[model samples]
Target: MSENILDIKDLRTSFFVEGNEIKAVDGVTFQVPKGKTLGIVGESGSGKSISALSVLQLIDDPGKIVGGSIRFKDEELTTAKTSRMRNIRGNEISMIFQEPMTSLNPVYTIGQQLREAYKIHQGLGKKEGTKRSIEMLELVGIPSPEKRVDQYPYELSGGMRQRVMIAMALACKPELLIADEPTTALDVTIQAQILELIKNLQEEIGMSVVMITHDLGVVAETCDYVAVMYCGKVVEFADVETLFENPRHPYTVGLLSSLPRHDIDQDELVPIKGNVPAPDEMPSGCRFAPRCPHASAICSELPELETQEDGNDVRCWIYTEQWDGEKGVKVYDNETTS
Candidate 1:
């Protein structure tokens, strides 16, 4: 068996609207090692969530997986039948969506929702399912699992509801878990608690995690590997320490510069200039060329994601030998203007 639990290569997912195609995830590739966390970080409209959705074959109408491969345990997921996907979805792989209230059915009690997973995956009856449901609720550290299981989603706090979502996703003890902005809606304390809970649970269950978030702090805290995405592609990929210490891609540098740092005194936060281009109006060359500080004539052509001497992958012209500009130009030091 391979060390990687999930491997995505050149994956493309697009949406057809008004006879035009929007490439939401354009030739994206990454790997998630077993019992480790991989953080996918980028701003909104960067295809972070779309890539995760494509893994479960959950793309709705007007959207489809156009090309590339999604391999889970050496099983090709893009061509997997509906029945096969159904068996894999909650039993071997699970996901916790951004919002808990919207994902959970309001009409059903939390117990009913949790029990359904056990019933479908393990063939457990109502009595046995309910018994396991309460145990799962307790495992996630819910205050009163016996009472909370019978209550509706609307009856619990946001943090509690999120815990219920985690419990539901883990009910089958999946080998892989995809957490999409799990702590986005919580307060600082609650967010910390939720992250800690996930880390503890991951250690307990020994599952690989794909953590999708825009927060760099979360990436630093939880991720072992990092993939910095921009627009619709992965611009940089490296281990968490290498990424923070020496980010190769200009977009990654811009993102790190924008973050507020208490360790070092700064005059102001350096925000990346300009808005993300519309999907239909994407640049023919490098997607970030319009906003990059080091963009040159060579940037008129898109650069391939190539490995550098340091063994990190970066999609930028500055690192290439054909770079027409000054040799060894410091992208991190270059100041971006509005």
Candidate 2:
């Protein structure tokens, strides 16, 4: 049996918006091993968050899992009932959302929220659960945790609130944690601190993590593997070092190039040429063809992700001998990988 904690295959999440069906996660496949972090990188509409939510079957009304299999701890989560899902959600797979303010109930004190969360999974008495919550707060680096536990979310700084959120997520000591843009709302220093806190906690608890973010820098600093998403599909999948050093998919290249570089010339930021395509109106062909610097005639016909010799997977015709971005050439008569 594999040591992986999470495995998703051909997962597709959709939503009903304006009387039309929209595909948020289209055939996403990946695995997260115990004690490892898999960074899912993409723009806002690339379906990274929805994919994570699908694993826990948290897609609310109007949004649904239309197709796929989600496996956690070798158990299939795709068809699991709500009661079964409840057991997995906090106890086996906790989530740290992007915004801390909305996640925590403002009506409750910090201690009350944490105690309730811990008690649900631990089945411990209120006193023991409260004690565990305070210990977790301290473990996450909150100063004078005993005192801080009595404070409200508004009393804490942005960084501190984020830490509390992390602590709450870890209170259950889950086997998997899905962090969706946990640091995007904070400043750089706070972002660093949160990332460090997550890394340290991951090491201590040995839980597999799914880190979803648009920032490539975060993925580079913390993740072991990367899945670069574009228009609801994973366009590039590779090991961290390989993806960073040798990204082949045009969308992945665009993302990496757009980052501001002090070492490079100010004019050299290679921003992605187009915004994310609308869900319903996604192009019939390659979704990123319009923006891809390497796009060609064959790109108008769509491209399938092709596996390469180096274990890097790319979904561009340029790499698959169908089109050449440079010199405007088309080599293949008709080629597709399904």
Candidate 3:
């Protein structure tokens, strides 16, 4: 096993909307191993993005990380000072957001934005910063980096702008890279290129990555470990291969069943029933109980994440001693489980 670069325990982030405290990330715990990628897979509103933000201490006013600890390289981040956190953000941990068009400053040239990280963190002068900025763009596979650095974000195409975001994020050689839906806005071909770029860069720099995405295909292609989250909590945590092979949680099963596979011939896609529960309207017991096909009376009580004999952790009553071995949870696409 690799050493962990980030360890989060019982993280709970919430937002105050309309005088109601809504839990966006509730009791989430996971670890990203050094030089490896951990994918947090969940549907929209599953708190995947918020969990990543909480790690960087970027939760704004009205949205707070109410509880839990975030330890980055054994340093506690939840209590870190603003100045210290700022230093940590671009220097040690950088994030590539979903939309480069919005994340990149339209008013500034690409070179200016990229150089900011170097100037602040590394104290590079204008000439040296510009040289380094062009190098980064080239490193991320942006053709004609010399010309591109002088251009504004609007002058670039969507894929090129996204590449710029990656260049900026990696300018400081951060130890951890948090990419939240990095390929969400790109076309299929561009998405593949972006994903490959991130993977190659990760291997080159030896940095740990926390990939927040709803696409299972992306998870399979890039992740070493996987965390399946639902209704703001982690329902399943396992190695990527184990997760796709032997998913134990109902929500995980549902997500796998919903994937559109070219190898498998399916007449209809099987989507998970019901939408993610609203934070204020969370159910009394297991958050997924309402939509779980196998939910029983015992499901009225929340289940803890329990480690199975195979070492995967799953949060479901079906795997516990109280299950009595008779109750069945209908997991789809489960033809190969041992």
RMSD of 2: 5.2
Candidate 1: misplaced stretches above 4 Å?
A: 118-145, 157-159, 260-267, 333-338
Among all candidates shown, the one with the greatest lDDT? 1
TM-score for each model: 0.91, 0.87, 0.90
lDDT by residue for model 1 over 118-176, one digit each (tens)?
88877899999999999878766687889999999999998889889988887777899
Residue by residue across 1-338, what tens digits does model 3's lDDT show? Answer: 33899999999999998898899999999989899999999888889999998998889989999999999998999999999998898789999987678789899999999889789867899999999988878766688999998999989999889888987887777899999988777677767777787787788989889998877878888999999998899999999989887788888888877765433454666798988877768997999989988888888899998888987789999989897334565464555321
> For every candidate structure, what is the RMSD over all alpha carbons to the true structure, in angstroms?
3.1, 5.2, 2.8
**How many residue pairs clash in each candidate at the backbone level?**
0, 0, 0
Ranking by TM-score: 1, 3, 2
Lowest summed-lDDT stretch of 10 residues in model 2? 329-338
Better of 1 and 2 by TM-score: 1
Descending-lDDT candidate ranking: 1, 3, 2
